[model samples]
Target: MSINELTKKLKNEAYSSLYLLYGKEKYILEYSQKLIVQAVLDEGSADFNLSSYDMEEQPIEAAIEDAETLPFMGDHRVVIIQNPYFLTGAKVKQKVEHDLKKLEQYLQNPSEQAIVIFIAPYEKLDERKKIVKALKKQGEVIQAEKMNVQLQKEWINHASKEANVKMTDEAVERLIELQGENLGLLIGEVNKMALYVGEGGVIEPSIVDELISRSLESNVFTMVEHVANRRIDAALRICYDLLKQNEESIKLMALLARQFRIILQVKQLKAQGFTEKKMASILSLHPYAVKIASRQSRAFSEEELKDLLIRAADADFEMKTGQRDKQLSLELFMTGIHKAKQTN
Candidate 1:
């Protein structure tokens, strides 16, 4: 199940006998776990009914034992099993043994009074494993992967609704600009905004600008856009702003070079008939970011993208080698981009 679907189910108080929560996104996984706990056990019963076990220290058998045990003062017990590394094929740092057969047996016939949640913080589970197949067949599974842009926007809307506040379109965009795709950070910022704006109030661009601090990656995106649009003055102003904030010019140049390379890669992939979705997957970038970069890439020829990357590299080398002032090197690189843009 998608994270949103699982969230809806939990909200509806539709409890499952068994759950397999695995994901690369720690925030989503953790949030979902909390929802399940809330749905299964009441606040008063939580202390006595909730049981947690680290699979690394205490094997699956131990958790299964706890699951089989009756709740002390409640009708239902919640057993949370963390770091079920056996679900994935990745090698562990230390050899922590797990009894997979116990989990498989529990999956075949889970406890009616218990909700066993297997937390696997892994990118992908080993589907070929019998335990995995059994769990999938018998329980609810939520894969908390990085959401695409539309889903992300929907999530923001949902969060706003939950907070009893409204976020304007521009506010949403600005929040995304400040927070990027980290849902944990975004949610925190949203909660603060919702409180600041008060109940039923709309969060606008000014509120966002006042509350949120710009991330380095977000500024890099802006700088790249400015460069792509040949807005040299705005681009240099951003650089100066970064420098005033004690950001190293070499570090900024590296980020610019990385963005340029992504643009170039996106361009080359597009030329070879790759879709935006495919390019995003290939580049391991957020689809929204890939979309924005795709638009920026069209403003520059392939040669221009390469020229910018080369200039960024030259600036990096000159500054690192003490051949030029660090700030001046970056300034020169921006000027080079302007000249390249003019020529192109």
Candidate 2:
């Protein structure tokens, strides 16, 4: 099931014994988790009923043991096992793998008294694994995809509403420009803006610039989005305007280079178990950039991306050295993208 479906089920009291939630997008899945927790366990009783486990650092069997033993004075229990990919590796103790099938049997008919949730983002679920089959039959699986510029706008609107803050479209655009387009950074920036602006939700460009000095989902980031998405014509226009407005060519290239570098890093980071939010911070790129970069990275073959990075490095070298005619090279570089011929 999708996050929407899962949310609907939990909201409607359609409880399941097990839930498998994993994806590039986490906000919606988090919402689903909360809804499920709320539905199955009372707010006042949450402390006793909810138990979480970090299987990457520990054993899944230990968590299962905790689940088997019910909470005191609670009608139902929730056990969340996170990052169990280690279970299939040699690093995992043999004792757990030998009894993996037992976990499957439990999922096949999980106790009515408990709700089990597994979170293993950025890792594949090997259906050949014993528990995977039972989960398919017994629970809901939710895949969360990260947001892009368009969706970023929707998120901004939603976040402002949540914070009881108001934002102008220009302020929203400006905020995104500074941050890049990652939902986490955008949300964080918006929260800051909301606080500074007295929760009036009144966001102006000047106030936005002052309050949330860091945002990845803003207009300049959108400008880059137009280029990476291969809306080259529109991107060219934006580029020309930025130049006209005295935006530094070196700075622009730095921005472009940072964008592509993040794309490459996001691809690798996502593969290495880095969460979307963590990838942005570690890459020192905007979360919004990481969000789209991860998706766009799939559009290029690993070789293509590597080649593009080489091109960016060359462009950066020439442009910075002033060894080449600036406008001509930058324009040629922009046009060169069409040669790649990939439409995002």
lDDT of each prediction vs. the true structure?
0.86, 0.72
- Per residue, candidate 2 scores C-alpha lDDT tens digits across 215-327 of 32244455556766678788778778778978777777777767666677788888899998898678765555576678777755666668777887888789878889777
| TM-scores for all predictions | 0.85, 0.58
Give the per-residue lDDT digits (tens) of candidate 1, residues 33-118: 98889877889999999989987787777888989999988888999989888787887875567777767778899999999998
Query: In candidate 2, what residue range of length 10 has the lowest lDDT sum?
Result: 87-96
Query: Which candidate achieves the best lDDT against the true structure?
Result: 1
Report residue 67 deviation for candidate 1 (angstroms): 2.0
Please provide the root mean square deviation of candidate 2 (C-alpha atoms, Å).
Answer: 11.3
**RMSD in angstroms between candidate 1 and the native structure over all alpha carbons:** 3.0
